[model samples]
Target: MGKEIDSTITFQNLSQKNMSFEQVFQHIITFMKKDPSGNFRLMFGTDSQVFNHYTKFITGIVIQQERKGVWACIRKVTVPRQMLNLHERISYETTLTEEVVSMFTKDHKEQLINIVIPHIYKGANFTIEGHIDIGSGKKNKTRVFVKEMVSRLESIGLKPKIKPESFVASSYANRFTK
Candidate 1:
């Protein structure tokens, strides 16, 4: 089992006040089941912000239906600061993402893909991808980590995305960490 991280998820369009993990899972499942013809994509990503004494990490899950926009849930956690280099920071972000994806997929594997329509393949079916907050370019300190991060994600059968394409982590989750 991976380290248990506490999370609070807000289901945008739903009227529910507070939702448990199971409830969120059910909500997503029901949403997919209700629209069997809609194209769907599930993405998971994490981003972190460092403060003088601690670091804040935010992880997000996005469920998108073709042209219908998206519904997402975010979890934020703050921990004592550690002197981590750029590589370490990116590595930690990726690890947190892996843990969240693994936890979700462990029990929801079948449910995640069972409802996809056979002919509506506009994007990935049920694959959970990781969006790292790193980019290419010699001036970017994190650039050297792109290959390593991608390989790490690939080792666990996950697709990886970096800057320019990794808006989920660099943009979406980054918003909450600040």
Candidate 2:
């Protein structure tokens, strides 16, 4: 829902900067091509931090090859004022992840899938996960919205993960929300 979802937006990781979304897509495809036999999880997640004046939201896109390596990049959006409500922040985070997910058209996903289909019987697998920065544990304050958030992601065809298992949101993207 923010400008970061636009075609002109840029995504960056440690070794790169100002990379267009197309470049990011190509990067993932190239990584998979390098090891088509590896299990890949293409995940999207967002985390936010409420600064004094604004909330900094960061959405991460990661292509992880189990027991191997990963290629990840993040897009950022900053709201003009601090977002104090817990539900609002969590919902906004999901919205941000959805925005990034919408960028990968059907053809783009097919391209990635085609690369691994040949190696499927060889242990190669692919899954798309939506990681929400909320937990279902009783002690977790975000537990209340877990169902809603998970359902939102599931409606988009993604397997949803949360809390301890949602490393992309709870760990990766969170680091930059500061």
> Which lDDT tens digits does candidate 2 get at residues 1-178?
3233476678998999999998999999999999999999999999999989999999999999999999999998899999999999999999989989988888789999999999999999999999999999989999999999999999998999998999999999999898
Best by lDDT: 2
- Give residue 143's error in model 2 in angstroms: 0.4
Error of 2 at 116 (Å): 0.2
TM-score of predicted structure 2:
0.96
lDDT tens string, model 1, 22-71? Answer: 66677678777766667776777889988899888888777777787777
lDDT against the true structure, each candidate: 0.74, 0.94
Question: Which segments of candidate 1 are over 4 A away from where they belong?
Answer: 1-18, 82-84, 117-125
Taking all chains together, the TM-score of candidate 1 against the true structure is 0.81
Clashes of each: 0, 0
RMSD versus native structure for model 2: 2.7
